[model samples]
Structure formats: structure tokens, C-alpha cells
Target: MAVVAIDKKDLLAFVGKALDDGELARLVTDLGMPVEKITESEVQVDITPNRPDMFSAEGLGRAISSLAGIKTGLRNYSATDSGVSVSVERSVKKVRPYIAAAIARNVKMDDALVKSLVALQEKLHDTLGRRRRKVAIGFTDFNKLKPPFTYKAVKPDESPFIPLGQSEPWTPARILKELKQGQDYGYILEGHGQYPLICDSEGNVIALPPIITAEMVKITPSTRDVFIDVTGTSQHAVHECLKIICCALADRGAQIQSVNINYGKKTLTTPDLSPLKTMLPIRTVNKILGMDFTTEQIKEYLERMGHGVEIKEKGKLSVVSPTYRNDIFQEIDLAEDVAIAFGYNNFEPILPQFSSIGKRSPSDVRAGLIRDLMIGFGFTEVLAPYITNRATNFEKPMLGEHPAIHIKNPLTENFTMFRSWCIPSLLEILAASKDQKMPQKIFEVGHAAILVDGKPVEQEKLAAAICDPKTSFNEMRSIVEGVAYELGLKLEFAGLDSHPTFIPGRAVEIIMDGKPIGVFGEIHPQVLNNFGIEQPVTAFELKLA
Candidate 1:
């Protein structure tokens, strides 16, 4: 979460209706903004990363004001045309293409406004810009730069130039090191064999994006106006950051100068905020909110939320969303507004309209049976993390497709991969317990992930492992067969010629009703050696259904 300081005057202007301390606290809590402290002049609200729009005091103020009925409108402030030109060279398209810039003119800079601008830039860079890789922002002393800037890629070892906050000039690579952003974030371009660089027409370095900016044009309190430039590999993200900065500055009463960007034959305006419309069936609103409001009532509610609602038919509503509200793409989202406006507490809490009671599925029943059988067999039931380390997941050399979900933004390498099978997890437990006893029997009934037809699906699975030196393939198979027999299931085996994680000749696939349900095999000597386990091991896994 990003903590933003709100000026008392600005806060009051945005949240028009005065709120008592308790009411203000409740509103902050409801909006997920934690009020760190309040003074006679200003209140500091902690804004979350996902809510980039709230990074500025104006945005937060507007949100609270609207909710409090102090304001009944939402509009993107119209931008003034500055006629600044930014040209995208063809050579940079494959490296880093997109660029957007906006000039904030006639703004009086003070400590409060300067700090707010800097804070907003850092927040957007970390959150929406994805730490500057997908989007990076550069603020220039508008008085220092010449108009019609150029954004393009340059050599990694390009000429040494001073970076923002640095006194000495350093090469691109050296600049990365001196700025402390090289080894950490400099690698984003290492794989591409090029680095994204920003410089003035005279070859003075302005920024080495995603790394550091030149110290020459850093924003300061003396700077009355600022030139903000965002460059990135992702056009959409770059444009979004542009809008974020533009809106935040507009809140401070700075006039926005739109810059025309040339991308081949197409020309686009920076900070573009065009209106978008989406239609929804009125019944959806009624069903979700349990409300019976007329179409006019719903329209009024949406309009109050900065949405332009039109009656499409007797039971359909068309919603025109301001360009900044990119989160509202679905009809149900508008329905939510209807619910909020209708008063969530006003709806009668009736029993489910349907008479039938919710019950577990047959698969759930089978899973319970498997759980009981495992416990009855003296096997201590264990549960493992659904997400597993990539090394454990793929290094095991398990046969069949790797099963596990992969996180897009993994906090660490240890949790990067999802578990496709339970065998590796059991093997991990066995490795840890080697010092405890000779024989360790454990069973786990949980979900395993797999990709089916390009979509991820999870299936309930049962896995059991015994780590006794005497454990063999037949012994594990008997336990597997016994569990199936107890569940009124017939099990048959087909020879498995080769399996990576199991002894090639000792593994067999378990078949039930002509469908392959599971596998039982002796742990391959190579697999055991990898985990530093000396005892012979056998493991089996069966699908719950």
C-alpha cells in the first residue's frame, strides 16, 4: 500500500460533506485506505497499489465525495493542447517502442505539491508500471529541455552521462551500477541484446529507463512546470502511466499539454481519455441485488457514480464509462452499483429462493471414504502446500506431463511452480524424516493441478508412500488394491515400459473400468539418490473419483 498525504483544504474540496472522526475512519476503512494519523491541517490515507487512481489526493477526495453524495459527477478533466512533438523511430519498435509525454504548465511548485508529485510517480512506477519494466516515468525540469524529444534504443556501453541524483557521469552499464538499479532491474533488457535509453537532441542523457534518470533535469520545488515522459515496451501500460500522472497533476491545478506521438502511420494523443459504453440486462441487476428498482432509478444510480446510463429496452441498460474507469467492463459491475445505491442493508435477507439444500458431490463422498481408509490403515494423513518449488516439481524427472500451476509473479523461486503430482511432495517429506525412523508410512488426499486443453484443472488424488527398506512394488500395489476394493472399485494393471521417476521395469499403471486411474512403482535408484535416500521405496497414487 502507498501512503499519500492529503492537504486539509484539498481533502475538504474533494470530500465536500464534513465527516466526523468516526465517520471518516469508517469511510477510510471501507475504501481500504488506512488513516495513519490526522492533524488539524491534513489527513494521511494509505492507498493500495491496485488502486492507482487513489494515489493522488484529488482522486481519493473525489471518491469519498462521490460516496458521500457531496459530488454526483465523474469526468476526465479536459486537457489543453501544448503541441509538443514526440517521434518514434522505426528502429526502436522491436526494442522499446511506446512513448508518451505530457507537460504540466503554469503550476506553482511548493514542498507539498513537489512531494506529492514525486510520491505519485514512485507509486505508479512500482504498482501500475510493474517496477518500471513495463512502464517507466521520467520527469524533466520543463525549462531545461528543448521541445520535440526523441525516444529510442542505444548501445549498452553508450557514452557516459550523469544520471539523476548522481554527481559523476557513467556509462550506461556503469550508470546502472552507480544507481543501484543495474543488477536488480537492468537484466530486463539483457535478454533483448539492447538497452532502452532516452537522450536530448544534443546527446545529453535524460534517462536510462527502468534504471535511473539524468540528474540534470530532476524535478524540484524551484521547477514551476514539469515535463513527464513515460517509455515502455508495453504501449498500453505506458499510456496508462501517462494518464495517471496527468490526472494527478491536473488535481493540483496544472494545465495538461497533449503531445502527439507518431507510431509509423498512426498518431495518438498522450493521456487519451475516451468514453466507452457497455450494455447489461436489467434482470442481472435484479437477480444479483435482489432489487426491483425501475430503469430510471438504476440510471440515476449509475450516473451518480460517473457512469452515463441509457435505457436500451424495457429491461436493458447501456452504461457509458469514463475512460479512466477501465475496471468496469462487465454488466455485473454496473449491477453492483445498483445494489450499492439501493442500500445493501435495505434488501430483505430471505432464505434461498430454491428449496433444495446444498450437498457435496459424489466425488466428495469418495474423497471422504479414501481419507477414512488411509487413517484406518495406520497411515498418518498429511497435507502439503498446493504450490511447490520448481526444482522439486520438474527435477524429479517424473514421467507424464508436469502437473502444477505456475504463478505469474512468484515471490520466490521456492514457490514458482505448482504441484502437478503428490509424489514429489511425499518424496520431500521422506527426505526430511530419514533421521527419524526406518519405516515411515504417510498418505495424503488433496488436489493436484494439470493443464487440460490449455486450461488448468484440478483433480482430487490420493497418494501413499512407505519408506521401509523392505518396501517393494508389490506391497505398495496391495495397499492400493485394498483401498480400491474397499470402495467397491475393481483395479487392473498394465505394464509401464518406462517412467522417469520410477524403476522402468517395476512400474505399472492402475486401470479401473477401462480408464487409467493411477500408477504404482518402485522408486528408481537414480531418483532415490537425488534425494539422498538410501532405503528402497515404493509409492502409489489413485484418482479420487
Candidate 2:
């Protein structure tokens, strides 16, 4: 979700009328964008990630107008051919293959307009752009560039140009080293043999895709005509980004124009503003909303939600989803849109005909016993998120080649993969508490999603860590032995070796019922250093029975 704050006057002007704070919030909430706060001068909204179109004031206003019946059905925008062609060279295909181009002509720019463009670009970059990995965007002064742009690759050391916000010309490699952007975004281009570059006819670089743009071609308050380019690993994502930006620019009185994408083997023009068509069953919509609406009434609601609908003979509707709305991927998505348009607050809730008592599952009961047992031993329980990155789950744990459930479209690198174990999470907590206190004993009886035959299997496990200057493997070993004793079970210990996560011979494997169950050991100095922890630590983990 993205939080957006817009000027009250600007929002009213875009909405084409004055709306009270409550009224605007209510209507926008119906659009799935809820109001976080509203004041005399500003309105802050929480926009869902699915509707990137609502990230800007122009997009939100357009949707509001259409849903309010001020304007209904699919609002179409046609892109005129700009005659600007961007040639795609084969050299950069191995790097960033797909490129889509659009020209926003007759753009009227002001301080607010400029800020809005930058905001939309950045918000899209964070979400649709996938942190500029799956997609990246670049915009420059259209009139300043000569026609016939070339997208190609070059040696990082050989290519030199003035990066955005800088006066000095630096090599691509040097920019990654010396500039702040390069330091932050250089990972996208660091290991590749050749880096991606976009150049105009006169050999002037417009901007480096996925990185900084050239200073000479950057957009400013005086810039009227704008050239937008989106390059990515996926062709579909590139086209979606172009569609979103073009729609926003069109709302600002700019003429949308198409640019030819010369992909060598095949050629295509970008900014495909055509709506995607899909079929929605009337019965399905009614079932989900729990309300029966006439086909004509349903069509009216769909139109108000900015979808073109055609009634079919059999309880089916042909829906044309607007190009700006990317969330409509299935019939269920249309059902959600219909519910929103029908007004959720107006729905009547049905009381349950049957009542029953609810109780925790068996796993929860076992977890409760383990948590209480650990707490009785003076260990504090802390909760951690299920998702984490590779550095903490793998590199820090020294468990290479371990696979976890990874997200396809991650918002940030911080929580990009699921955890298969709970011990690493415990260590991360200890590392962050270095300044607070010593002897920080903590434990977690949490769920871990382990991959089973390519599917995730969720299970509850217990892990505990005791950190202090005098921490040793013996301390953790005794804790495990005492727990087993309380459970009235016999356990055996065996030397654990060959694991890089702990010291060579200091680690031990716990065996119960002639089966290897768990392990505990003094934390390796190298592992502690990797986590920035100076104190010694000992930890143990096992599945909850």
C-alpha cells in the first residue's frame, strides 16, 4: 500500500468540483483507496498496491469521476503517432531486453506538475518497476532530443556521460562507485560484462535504464514535450508501465503518441491503449456480492466502475477492462469491482443460524506448552516475521544451497523469501539488541514454512538463544537436557562436525529414541562478526512434539 497526500485545492480541481472532506473520503474509500487523514489543506490516502493508477491525483480523480456517474464506461484515449523511432540493438538483449516508448506531447508543466510526474515515476518504480529490476523508466525533454534513438550496450569503462544531478562526466563503472545512485542501484548492472544505455541520434545519452539519467535530457519545469521509455526483463511489464504513465499524462492535457519499437526481428509500436476484454458470469457476481441485480443494473454498475459491459444471452457479461487498471486479471477481480461499485456499507449482514464454540488446533496446544516451559526457564519469547532475505537466512547462517519459498514479485529485498528454520530469526533478534543489555535470553515457538516436494509445509518449531560473554555450548546442552528430562524422555548427544555454521567439534547433535532430533553449540566467531555481535552466544532448536 502507498500513502498519498494531495493538496485540497488541486484534488478539487482535478475532481472538477468542491467536495467536503467526509464526502471525498467516503467516495474514494468505495474505490478501495481509504482516507488515512484529511485536513483543511491536505488529504492523505492509503492506496492499495493493485491500483497503481490511483497513486497520482490525476488518476484518482479520473476514477472518482467515472465511478460517481460524472463519466461512465471506458474512457478512451487514442495515441497519435509521434514518428519517433527507438531502435533496439541486439547488444543489450542479454541484459535488459524489452523496451517500450511513448511521447507525451503538448505537456503543460508547472512546479506541481513536475513534482507529480516525479512522484508517479518513483511510486511506479517501487511497485510495478520491482525496484527497477523487472522494469525501469526514463523520461527526458522530447523536443531536446533528435529522432531515431538507439538502445544498446557498451563497455562500462568506455562509455562516459553526465549523470543526472551531476556536472562531471564519469564512466558507467565510476558512477557506480562515486555517485550515490550508483552505489545504491549499481547491483542491477555490476556483474554484467556490458551495461545498458539509451542514446539519441546525435550520440547524446538520454538516460541509463535502471540507473541515473543524463543531466542534459532530464525533465524540468520548463519542459513541455516529454519522451518516456520503459525497459524491463518482461515485455508485458514494460507495456503496462508505458500505459500507466501515458494515461496520467493524458489527464494533464498532454497528447499521447506512439513510438516505434524496432526489435530487429519484429517491429511494434508502444503505448497500446486498448482495453482488455473478458467474460464475467452474472451468477458468479451475484453469488459473491450476496445480492441479486438485474443485468441492466449490473451493466450500469460496471460502467460506473469504468468497465465496458455487453450483456450476453446466458447470464454472462463481456467486460472491457480499462488499460490503466491492471488488477482485473480474472472473473473474481471483476466481482470485487462490482462489490465496490455496489457499495459495501449498504450490504445487509445475515445472522448465523448455527452457533458453536471455537478452540485452538492441536499444534497450537503443543506450542503453548513449549512456550510456557521456556518462559518458566526465564527465557523471553519474541515474535518475528515469516519472510526474510537471503543474507540473514542463508549467508549469515552459513547454510549455502538451501532453498526457501521465494516471492515472485517482491516489494523489497528485506523480506523476499520464506524462512525454513527459526534459529536464524532468533540470532537476528540478538544482533539487533547488542546495545540494550547482556545475557539476553530469547526463544520462539513459531511456524516455519519448509519446502516439501516443491510445496510449502508449515510446521511449529521451538528455538532459543542465550547471549552473554560467558556463553558456551555446555549451557545450551544443559537447557536441552533439562527440557527432555521434564518431558520424561531419554536423549543422547553426538559430536557434530563438518557444518560451517558452528565450531568444528564444539557442536553436538541431540538424539532421542535412536533418532537425531536437534543440535546446539557455541556460536562461531565468524558468524557473530557477520551479524555485528561482539558477545558470545549459544542456541538450540527442535520441532515441537
Candidate 3:
């Protein structure tokens, strides 16, 4: 989510209605955006990434007007041919491939409008642009540049221009090495042989794509015409970015003009302000929202959300959303809008009917008994996460790798696989709690996962550890025997030798009905060194079910 601040006066002026702070906050909150705070100067609201069209004050005003009934239905804009063309060279086809551009004439640039434009560009760059890797936007004074612009890729040494806020010209390589922005975003072009560049007819560099714009031509309060260029790897995102900027400018009394993009084989015009059409079935709306809405009511609700709706049949509607709205993809999106328009609090809550009464399972009952038993023995129960790394579970614990379920697309290295045992997690907790007082005892009762025939299998297990200077294998064995006595099960112990995680000849395997269930022993000194713990530890594990 992105938080944006809009001037109080500018918001009211664009909305074309008078609203106090309380009313304004309520309206935006009802539309699913919470107002963070409202001061005397501005109102701050958190905007979701899906609604990038509402990132600016003008965009918010447009939406507020429709929802408040001051102005309803989809607002349309017409683009006239500017005759200014941009030529796409084959060199750039592999670098930063797609580009969309437009021109805005007679733009009324005030301090408020200028601030709004800057904020919109930065917000878009941070969100949809993926920090400028997926998309980048550039703005310049249109009167300074000539027509028939060229967008191409060139060697780093060949592209030299004065970057913004600098007086001397710098090569592309120098910019990447010296400038702050280049250092921050230069990784996007790390392995490319050439860099993307945009220049005017006279070879005056307009901008270095995904980097910095030229210092010669800049937009200011006196500039009446503006040039907008959006370049990125995605065709859909580039076009959508252009449409959003054009619509935002148009809302500020600017005349939008389309530019011709020449791709050597075909020509295309940018800033297409046409609406996207889709069908919404009445039954889907009713089923999703859990209420029946009349055709007229649905039409009104869609219109309130700035959509054009037509009753095409008995139980269907032909709904068209504005081009700036890139969030709509299916019928459920329209139903969400209907819910918003009808007010989420107005819906009634109903109890769902079930086939039978619910009760605790046998495993749950046994788990409760074990929890009580552990607490009665003065052991603190701890719950560890199911997701853990191999280093903490295997390498540090002196246990070699085993078949554990791993994540295919892990976001980070810290959490890449499921834990195969509970002992490692308990040890990790003790390692972090070394600063506390001595004689710490902890236990965990949870599921451990393992692979069988290439499929994951979970088993219920209980593990306990006592970290104290006097802790020994005999103390742990006594506790294990007490647990078996409470559960009314006769158990036998067999001496274990040469265990990798425990001391040799000091660990014993617990048996029930002539089948080995688990082991209990004193942790090896080398294992304590691996976990950075200075105290000795005695631990035991048992398979509960």
C-alpha cells in the first residue's frame, strides 16, 4: 500500500463539491481506502496497489465525485492527432522493448498541479514500475523538442548527455558509476550489451530510459505543453501507464493529443482513451454478494463506480470500465464494486447450516493430556514454526540430511523446508535464550514431516530438552519413564552406541511392544558449540501416534 497526501483545497475544488473533513474521510473509507489522518492542510490516505489510477489528487476527486452522486458514470476523453511521430529503431527491440508516448497541450500548471504530478510519478514508479525495473516514466517540455523522435539502443560510450541537476555531460557508463539514482537502479541493465535511449529530431537526448532525463528540457509552471514517455518490458503495462498519465492531465484542463509510434513495419497511436467492455451475469452478482439486486439497481451501482452499464438481456449487463482502470479482469470485480456502492455494513449476517455437531477427535484429546502432563512436570511448552531452514534442522544439530519437503519457489533462504524433527527447534530456542537465568527446560509437541515414496508424510511427536550444568541422560530417562507411567504403557530401554547427535554409550532407545519409538541422551559437546550454547543439554523424543 502507498500513502498519498492531497491538498484539502485542491481535492474539494476538483470534486466540485463542499465537504468537511469528517464527511470526506467517511466517503473514502466507505470506498475501501482508509484515511490515515486529516490535518488543516491536507488529507493522507492509504492507496492499494490495485488502484493505481487513484494515486493522485485529480484521480481521487474523479472517483469521489461519482460515488457522491455529484458526477456519475464513466467520463470519456477524446485524443486528437498531434502529427508528432516517434521512430522505433531495431537496436532497442532487445533492451527496453516497448514505449508509449503522448502530448498534453494547454496544461494549467500551478503549484498544486505540479506537486500532484510529481507525487503521481514517484508513486507509480515505486509500485507498478517495480522500482523502475518493469517501467519508467519521463516528462519534458514539449515546446523545446522537435518532432520525429527516435528511440533506440546504443553503446554506453556513445550515449552522452547532461543528466538532470548537472551542468557537464556524462557518458552512460559514467552515470552508472557516479550518479545516486544510477547506482540504485543500474542493476536493471547489468548484463545488457547496450542501453536504451530516447532523443529528439536534433539528436538532443530527452532521457536515458530507466535512468535520468536530460537537463536541457524540463517542465515548470510556465510550461503549457508537456511530453510524456513511458518505456518498459511489458506492452500492457506501458500502455496502461500512458493512459493513466494522460487521464490525470486531462482532468486538470489539459488537451490530450496522440503521438504516432513507428515500428518500421506498422504504426500505432498511443494514449488510447477507449473503455474496455465485459459482460456481468446477474446470477454471479447475486451469488457472490449473497443478495438479489434488480437490473436498475445494478446499473445504478456500476454507474456510481464510474462504469458504463447497459442491460443487454434479462439477467446480464454489458459493463465497460475506463482504460485507466487496470484492475478489472472478470465479473467478480464488478460484484465487488456493487458491494462497495451498497455499503459493506448494510449486509446482514446469517448462520450457515451444517449436517452434524462437531466434537474433538481422539488425537486432539491425547494432545491435551500430553500438554497437561508436560506442564505438571514444570516444563514450559513452546510452539515452533513448521517452516525452518536446513542449517538449523540438520547441519547445526549434527544430523546429516534426510528426505524433507522443500519449497520449490522459496522467497528467502531462511525458510526453505519443513522441519523433520522437533529437537532442532527446541535447541534453537535455547540458543537464543542464553541471556536468561540457568536451568531452562522447554518442550514442543507438534507434527514432523518426512518423505515416503516422494510424498510428504506427517507424524505426531513430542520432544523435551533441559539445559543445565547438572543435566544428564539418567535425568531425561527418569522423566521419560514418568511420562510412560502416566499414559499406562510399559516401556523398555536399550543402550544406543555411536549416535551422531548424542554421546557414545550414554544414549538409550525407548521401546514399546518390542518396537523402537524414540531415543533419550545427553547432547554432544560439539553440537553445543555449533549452536553457540555453553551449557549441557539432555533431551528425549517420543512418537505419540
How badly does each model clash, as a count of residue pairs?
7, 0, 0
- Candidate-wise lDDT, in order: 0.76, 0.85, 0.89
Off by over 4 Å in 1: 1-10, 30-50, 89-97, 309-318, 374-458, 463-542
* lDDT tens digits, residue span 409-439, model 2: 6666688888888888988998899997778
| Candidate rank order under lDDT | 3, 2, 1
**What's the distance in Å from true for residue 501, model 1?**
7.3
lDDT of 3 by residue, 428-510 (tens): 89999998887999998898888999999898999999999999988998899999999997899999866678988889898
Candidate 1 root-mean-square deviation in Å: 5.3
- What TM-score does each of the candidates earn? 0.77, 0.90, 0.71
> Best candidate, TM-score-wise?
2
Lowest lDDT sum, 10 consecutive residues, model 1, at 396-405
